[model samples]
Target: MQISYLQQWLTTPTYKIHRSQLRFWFSLSLTFSVIYSVLALELAFRGNYLIDSDARQHVFWMQRFLDPALFPNDLITDYHQSVAPSGYAALYWLIAQLGIPPLILNKLLPTLLGVITTSYCFATCLQLLPVPAAGFIASLVLNQTLWMRYDLVSGTPRAFIYPLFLAFLYYLLRRSLLPCLIALALQGLFYPQCVFISSGILVLQLWRWHKGRLCLSGNKQDYLFCVAGLGTAFLVMLPYALQSSEFGAVITAAQAKISPEFLPGGRTPFFHDNFLEFWFYGKRSSLVPRLSRITPLIYTGLFLPFLLWKSSQFPLARQVTPKVQVLIQGIIASLGMFVIAHVLLFQLHHPSRYTMHSLLVLLALAAGITLTVSLQALFNWAKCSPKSYPWKGYLARGTTVFLAIVLIIYPVFTPFPYAKYKQGKEPLLYEFFSQQPKHIMIASLSEEANNIPSFAQRSVLTSEMYTIPYHVEYYNQIRQRTIDLIRAQYSADLTLARNVIETYGADFWLLDRTAFTPEYIRGSNWLMQFSEARAVVTELEQGIIPALSGIMEQCSVLETEYLVVLPTDCILKFAQRKRN
Candidate 1:
């Protein structure tokens, strides 16, 4: 009766099922979507207080999305739009029509992307293995990684593109070319790097298929599908290509600015680093050595051995088929990409943000191989005259369940004290900003400036400065004028201090204590070393130091030394002192 009821319900137009056996899949997908949506809403409501720099930028842009006309005519030209991919901006612009706050949209969109991507993974696995357990396990495994959670919470543009790229791959595997092409083109808009890597894999797959080396069961439709998809992707990229003169210049500049020495490392080869670090290491840490940045290669190494073992388990005929060959080729191509990336690009101090797509692909391949081999090994152990091993069945089942939990729940819950502010400082920052006047000109380190608006509710100029130094080369050619303006405006502390008093006429300065440390302020020496610095610091500095006792005489501390204000003339005097 239950089965009949389920069948009847699935037959209903609102819950239509094209495949009789897929009734449960529809229910499962709907359930997952609901759960993911709820979690996303919770995260958004909780707010990303920990790493609010990127989040705040998204919010600010989302605000621009809400009121497009509010942005200056040179807004796009100012940042050299190439610094960040344009997809998120475009999406925010579209979503703004719905009147949702930037924060809400940021959380909601990524959550939806996550759910859709997970569902697509399940669907793709079903086609390959045609087993419910395999589909479920695949979905669970892919979701278990720290990578997904990091992307989900960071609110970065790559987070939005990652899932879409995966979904496109799934569609391609199923011989759905038109949809694949559409997805491919759209992904280009979000993150071209992802598209580049994904397309490389796809092209390799197709080449294997063409040479009769891959044994796919599909006919002409599959070939047409792939061609159409690739064609569509090209077409979609055409507009951007025409605009490429500007884009190309930016890319060249950014590449030039990246130091060839620092490699951003995280969990690699699966277990070298914990699952948590692999996915959510946040910013590059000094504690994590340069060699550690290449940890992702560890996953690649593990995958190769596992793939060899898995291939040995299959008969030669099965392994030789086009489909299997294509899969093998894909694995190899992905690894090759990773190796090249590690040897060349990874050492450039590029943030995980830049490597996320590659990371996702590499993880997917590694996890897929690991799950396949581990499951096979467990099954063999369970069946091998298990009378010798009393708890073999239980052990196998338990192991499977444990892995499932790791893949599914770990991402959902691991790194305990999830969503809390870093060291509980975010709330203090938030409270401080909440009390500030509007449209204040804040001169501080890039991270603090980017973070203040989200935490405190005040507007800031040049909060994106941190990205600026890295993207200086690109900005020089594409956004030269704006770059010049920012440089001229904030080149010195005196200039910034004076500008704060004159231009925006700001009454307060909210400075992060860490930002004042020599290491943080080293590059902006003019702001730190001027003779009038004592006076500016006196007004802005909250507490007293024995060495700088008279400094506080000229100014009174505000709410805390973390925040202070000075007379407009005093700030101007500081600027003139430096000039003389």
Candidate 2:
């Protein structure tokens, strides 16, 4: 008797109740999005010295927007700024005009983006299934998945993709031509790779499955819509294709294959020995990366087709709109781009980029519909059970309630603050550099150099974060700089150190306390790639104290527990003293 009432409440709402259900679900979806985003913001602002891991690479350069004096003629800053998408840069510049520095804005922007993504996702789910409850579940799943990933919280160009892409999907499904074109244009300006996926979807829409075979879409409106979308896509993508980078050409697969930067422990780590990892789960190469972790309940989406086949038993399945084909087209478009990206290699960026965002959106819709259908099925079974089989009704009701409880409480057990915020451990180290002249460049072989640019707002000669090797010209300079720094840091002669300091205009030398030891050299994979570093290890093992170490007490300007900073003038003076 209770089962019938529950089914009626879910499936047979009056028009006024249905409107209220829509309002309730939409509000819930937005509420969850706000909650997740607030948690990320908490970590982002938890410490004055914290930054999102990727923001250290992409956003550090944006500090120049507020003050042009920062990172002047800086190679690391220049390369990153040049590669930033125009629209993304402009947005930051505009925000900076309003006096919010990019780093602070970067921390706050994700909440707004998350809210927009939640709004569009909920509306799009409604177009697919027309069930307000399903929309809530879909947006809920998408929010949970996004919060777990670094992409959404990073506030980089890719963060714009979710809202822009979902808006494109929603507007297209609604047949709103102008809005869809605008979404496509914005996506191109923010993340151009998604324009290809949008184009692929437009092309695929030109066909229709009729009877047993596929044929061209009979409606003229379909052709008109697709042609307009494709034309807009072409216009937005043309600038990226024609424009050449000052950093020279993107590294080819042949080039990356030979470089240590692409090896197992290398910076990028693209080529893996494990087949499953390389083809299926590799961060760069995979078709669908992090499948299980995408959403805890994503596996339920796999049962959607089966449930749809038994639609008679799952009454809610019949309410799924024909527009659900948009989900299928999205999957095909993502997969098609994924395959093309692999064949073309890094030219399209990473293959995983083509699929991961779209996968989350598609799976969320499928899983939401599946959850609603399954619940209704259980309720139906309970309602139809014979009086003799009272236990069956109890089992059905228990299962239905249990599924709902798990879905609601799943987030509490999962880890929090997956925002991947990297905190600066050496406050003294950053304070030291922050006080230096803006033009001053610090030279270092220590991993701590990676955090210096963002935390100290000062330039470093080269650090692990700045060693991105996608552009041949930029990386070649970075590689040589690394080699030179390694040799100078460990050489017994002060002459090599003097030459490197002069060549890079390095104002200071930063060193780890253990920098002179052989174990330090042996443990650093980045340094070991160069023969100079390996030779230094051999020298240290033979009890050859480096010239820099011999003068450490006199040359040191500032000393911390783990680090020491030496002025270049001091090093140069020591070289002169040794010559006399």
Candidate 3:
């Protein structure tokens, strides 16, 4: 019996032999992977390390490796504290054992994992499209979407998980159940967020099975696989889960001490009037403006038309079978996860960061359509006979070439300065801290100030203490109560300031010249008095300072230069008199 073309394509021994094509796919994968790794390493070593309030917890964990027992029961306890993800921590620990300093390992390990993840992402893309070019194209598109900007520079665990999750999905699509289960289980160990994504994929897989698209031997095996995958993942995660439990005590204590209103609302308006200002005027800002915001109606304008045009060009583009339909449904479901999180849970101030996965899905669909249409157009133009036309053959080749160039070369050469841009105020602070060797404690209004401890070999605190409160809340609660007692006894005069400073054992007050301006301080009776006495040692200046004049009047100058505030003679004399 003559085999149908689809059957021949699926069952042929030549198609099954991946090794024959492995060389090209591997080469393309490595090229882009190396570029991301290099970028990550550069950021880790050369760039200053700090990631808002949430990431400060990770830095705390890395610090604990100096004395494992320092973290009670081997748990990470920091602000927004949770059990540390074992995969990255374990890797960092091992590198630390090899005598690589935390500063270097922080960059090196994430870079290595990113490269591994990118390589696997390439492999997975190749399996789905089976065009040598598809692997290159998909990898390139993913690379171009600023994957390195976050993972390489910021060293986020989410970056490490993305490629791994993509690889697992690729294996799942190919019906490699065992490998898929293993990948899923491993992902659970590294990033628990993977569980939500894995659950979505399992639903899709079960739908495929129910529709008779997946020819499993029995329902029992399927059930066993699902249970085993989830069970194994949980087992691997047990240690970290237990470690995170202590954090509840910390949060509860912190909440009791501080006002609930003090926490920043995670939700904000999705659309703001000042949206065009960032896109058109402030092009050089560190915060990456959301694509949705930059072109408010573009999602509808471009996406709908392009999707329609691409679907028409490719006959198979319309999802037909139960399996293909399930896959499409899975992508939609993943995007829905992002949408719901942004709309309800996350503060609207950072919709762009949370919507990264959704953006990736959109770009992936765009890439797939672009390649399919471009190849089809080429095949028609060539007008070769059926045997020579090789529809699949041309697609595989063209996609590979396009991807190799776009993903690998474009990021390295692009003048975006993503690493520098994302570094924000932390790098500038690191430079200043490195120049000073004071053991004095420095307090600031900015979270970036916390990074000074790492650079200056001094103790530093920030308003982040009150905001995140994490594991430190337990300690801070005691400190706050002590401060309150000192304040009530002394009243709101200079006497209260002196008593609080002595009680807190603080030597230096490092104000954020950008955030704690004259206008903002005017509203606070305490800050107004505190600024009057503190002598300006340095004035930390940035370009944004001039534009924030409305907020500046609240602050009084302790320092004239606007570089950094160290206690000057006049300030020290005022503080001494208050103490007396």
Candidate 4:
């Protein structure tokens, strides 16, 4: 291809794309979506009915919709089901009514949602930039960002945030009021946090920048659009406001700061001593970055505005749409909500939730535009100096090709998109526990306890993985269980062990074969959260004979190298026989 042809495509690719151009853009976007969809399906079927970790916490209770007998009288199941959004639950209930299993639906939904999300992302970016290639590249970057996390693959309430939020943006840009309202309502129904973001945009649209000052729009349609959109948002959110969860009041920042469960190494581990993490990355106070790690490309979005300002160096920079202002409105609104969330503490939910989805969408678009502009700038420079120094042109074009490959190709090599948060490996263990009575409660501190509720259809007294300390009543109960389990496991007194089983009404006591060792307690995050457990650990280190350990071989109904399951009844019977 001639350098002039490449330059023309980079600089001005038709504002109203040619039929052929649209096909090329759609083809690239579709290819990326299909790759992600296939990977997600493969991951879904990779193990023994594997579910994402967050999905386990959110979607496991939905199985009851298909089989009413599942998770009967289970705290974790009941709590998650109770807290799940009315619309989210209803959507799955409707799917289950089609005779599809929840697991099957969960696996299948991501592929469709991924396509919908990508389509809207592409359209929204196109609406902003008008270049179909920009839209395609934006969606490509978005797919990469999403596949890195569990949001899309989990197919939980959070999964809808991307598609619904992007749909809202697309409709808003098109000034299509009815569809926008529906997207707004779905956002509230599905992911609630995103409704605030949509409302922010609506609110911003009512105010227009004119003559170098921000002035309220006098346009009647603007008022109507804002009114209709905000009204729909209010209607959807009102139900949640009126409803109450049996889990009790959400935990406050004051309460969380004082609790061990929110401290370092605690279950939620939100409050960090490190300043950067505590303020900017804290789950409750931070922005989109609440996690300990994320793809490095996410940071490129921070430099988007700077590049836009210096667009003069490259003519291709002119393609960035003025509608990029909408994303700025979203960030401003997200930040405002983030501040309010911190001020109100748990009343508004995690601060990170408010910003994460919006920021990711914005970042992906910005990164896409930035990469496009940077490559175009380099390519354009290469052609300009071809005659003066032919080597200069070759050098510039070679660098552009290398950089383009790295930007476009980097995401595929990072990690397997399908290897999500949780997967089931021990089929024998799952099958054995799943056969137990629905009302049976298993008690354990081992990490395996985390999998039982999802795989085995039983309640765990507590598990280290899912002890999100957002509710005082729930976390307190879990906290007490952690303390008692640790105390009972390390005590030489047989009565102490029996009391634990009686107090929790535990049907089975799942234990690691080497749970009595000093390392187990020291390594256990849940146990170490309580200062009381430290004394227990110290006693065990000095070789205290654990009453539970002595009875394991006699009472265990099943034993593996890694774990043993002791029936509480058998344990009590063994103690009685010994006493006799």
Best by TM-score: 2
Arrange candidates, best TM-score first. Answer: 2, 4, 1, 3
lDDT tens readout by residue for model 1, 177-258: 6677777877877765455555665666545344646655355665665566667667666766666343223223235324
Off by over 4 Å in 4: 10-16, 282-284, 290-313, 316-321, 373-386, 391-396, 577-580
Model 2 RMSD, rounded to 1 decimal: 1.6
> What TM-score, over all chains together, does every model reach?
0.66, 0.97, 0.64, 0.92
Candidate 3 residue runs with Cα over 4 Å from true position: 1-22, 39-57, 67-77, 80-83, 174-179, 209-221, 233-289, 292-326, 335-355, 358-370, 384-417, 420-440, 446-448, 464-466, 469-493, 511-580
- lDDT per residue for candidate 2 within 1-580, as digits (tens), equals 4777766655542233557767887899999899898889888888878998899988898999888999989999999998989899999999999999999988998999999999999899888777777778888888888887878899998899999999999998899999999999999999988898888888888888899899999878789888999899888888889998999899999999988889887888898899999989887888777665566786687788888788888887887878888878889999999999989988988999999888777888889888877877787787787889888778877886787687667777766536778989999989988998999999999999999999999999998888998999999999999999988888889999999999999999999999999989788877776778889888898998889998888989899999999999999999998888
Candidate 4, pairs of clashing residues = none
Better of 2 and 3 by lDDT: 2
Q: Which candidate has the highest lDDT of all?
A: 2
lDDT of 4 at 390: 82
Off by over 4 Å in 2: 11-16
Relative to the true structure, candidate 1 has a C-alpha RMSD (angstroms) of 8.6
Please report how far candidate 2 places residue 244 from its true position, in Å: 1.2
Q: Which consecutive 10 residues in model 1 have the weakest lDDT in total?
A: 261-270
Taking all chains together, the TM-score of candidate 4 against the true structure is 0.92
- Per-residue lDDT for 1-580 in model 4, tens only? 5666665564445554467877777788978888877977886787674777777788778888878987667766777787888788998999999999776787888888989989898888777666666677678778877877777888889889999999998998888988989999989889998998789888987887789999998989879988998899889999888887677788888888898777887777778889888777666557756343345655666777887889898566677767788878888888888888878878988888888778888878777676666667777777777486788667766775675575467766667574465766567778898888888888888888888877777788888766767877876776778778877777787676788889888899888887888788788777787787788778877877888888788888887778899899987886676677
Q: Is candidate 1 or candidate 2 better by lDDT?
A: 2
Which candidate do you rate higher for TM-score, 2 or 3?
2
